[model samples]
Target: MKNVLLVLFLSISMIIIYVFIPQQQSIVFQPNDSNANMAYIPTKEETQFKIKYTHSIHLTDVVESYKITPSKKIHQYELMYEDFSIGMPSNAEEGETFEVLNGSYYIKNMKRIFPFFHLRIGQVRANHTVIFKNVEYPLSHSIPPGTSVKVEIRTLNFIDLWKGVNILESL
Candidate 1:
C-alpha cells in the first residue's frame, strides 16, 4: 500500500510541473527601447497607394440621405446605421502612426512571400469597424466641383474558422 501511494503521488507531481510551471516562466515578446513590443508594429517599409473615385449624383437622390454634424474641434456624420467621426486626433494628424499588412488582391507576379499593396490604411484596433487616423469621406454628393462631403467606408474580414479540419461546408 505504501509503495502504490508513493508512485501515484510522483506521477501527479510530474504532470503538474510539466504542464503549469514552464508555461508560467516563459517570457513573451521582449520590449524595445521605445517600450513597445517589436512584434506588434510593422518593422519593414510598406508601400501604399492612394486611390479616389467620384460617385456621380442625381438631384433626386444626391442630397436625400445626408446628415452632417460639425463640432467645435471636428465634424461627425450620421448616415443610416453608422455615425462617422471625421479627422484624426490633433497629435496623430501630425504623423505619428503604425500600420499592418493587408492584401486586397493577391499579386501573382511577386514571390508568394511579398504581397503587393492594393491599398494601405492605418491599422484598426481589435473589434473596431473603421480604420484609425482616416477621414471618413462620404461619396454622396452631386456638386459641380470641390464640394466637401462626408463618406463612410467599412472593411470586412472573413476568417476561415475551420482551416485544419478534415471537412468543409457543403453549399
Candidate 2:
C-alpha cells in the first residue's frame, strides 16, 4: 500500500510541474553595469506599465500622483520627465543609435523580462529613440533638474504584473 501511494504522489507531482512551468530565457547585458530606474509607482487600477529612474537626477514639477485611465488594448502611462538621464553608448552622440541584443531588464531586483529580439537606436539625446522589434520608444526624457522621470514597461504576463516596485540604480 505504501509503495502504491508513493507512486501516485510522484505521478501527481510530475503532472503538476509539467502543466505549470513556463520556459524562460535569461540574458545578461554587457559592460554589465548599466544604470536603469523605475520613475513611478503603479496604482491598483493601473495594469500596463511601471516606471523608474536609472540614475539619481533632479526633476521639477513632474506629476507626483496619477491613475491609469482608459485604453483600447494596451494602456500607455506617460511619465513626464523633469530631468532625464544623459547616458549614451561609447562614441554615441545626440543623434546616433546603438543596439543591445539578447538583453535582459530586471525590475526592482525581482522580475526579469527579456525581449524576443532587439533593434538599433536611430538617434541619441537626453531624449532619444529606443527601437526594439520595430517598436520605437524613448531612451531618455526631458524633465526638470532634481526630479526623476518614470518609465512604463508593459505588464502583460500575469506573473510579471504583480511584481511592480521601484527600479534599482543599476541593472
Candidate 3:
C-alpha cells in the first residue's frame, strides 16, 4: 500500500513540475550583409573611337543625346563629341558653308523608376557632308570633303548577379 501511494505521489509531483516549469525556445537572429547598396555598386568606363572618312555625302539633320541614371542620387550624362574635326572642306563649292553647333544631349533630371536596372542612351556625333553641284543648294545643306575626328564615349557598367558563381568569383 505504501509503495503504491509513493508511486502515485511521485507521478503527481512529476506532473506538477512539468506544468509549472518554464521551457526556453531556441531562436536564431541573423542579419543580411550583402544587399544592393553594399554588393551591387555600379561602375563607369571611358571608351574611345577613331572615325576617319572622306566622301561626298548629304546631311539633313543629326541628333545626339545620352541619359543613364539608375537611381535619383546617381546620374551619368554626356554631350555630343569630345573632340572633332568638324568643318567644311576648303575645296567646298563657292556657296558651300557649314555650321557647328554645341548643345547638351541629355539633361539630368531626378527621376528613378527602377533602382536596380540601368541603361545607356545616347548617340555619338560624327562628321558628315553633302555636295550640291550646279543645282541651287539650300542653306541647310552641309558637305564634308574630309573627316578625321576622335570620339570619347563614357558608359555605365553594372555587375550582373544572376551569373554563375564562377563568373562572380572571377570578377
For residues 8-111, could you state the per-residue lDDT of candidate 2 as single tens digits?
99999987665555322111111112233222222334333322233323322221111233321222223333333453213323332332323421111112
| Model 1 agreement with the true structure over 89-135: per-residue lDDT tens digits | 21212222322223111111111111111212112211111211232
Per-candidate alpha-carbon RMSD to the true structure? 19.8, 15.3, 24.5
- Model 1: lDDT of residue 33: 29
Worst 10 residues of 2 by lDDT: 24-33
lDDT per residue (tens digit) for residues 1-171 in model 3: 999999999999987666555332111011122221111111233111111222223222332222333332222221232233354232223333233446312222223222222211112322321111211221111111121212112221222222211111222
Clashing pairs in 3: 57-129, 57-130, 129-143, 129-144, 130-142, 130-143
Per-candidate count of clashing residue pairs (backbone under 3 Å): 4, 22, 6
Ranking by TM-score: 2, 1, 3
Q: Supply candidate 3's per-residue lDDT for 94.
A: 35
**Residue ranges of candidate 3 with Cα displaced over 4 Å:** 26-171
The whole-model C-alpha lDDT of candidate 1 against the native structure comes to: 0.21
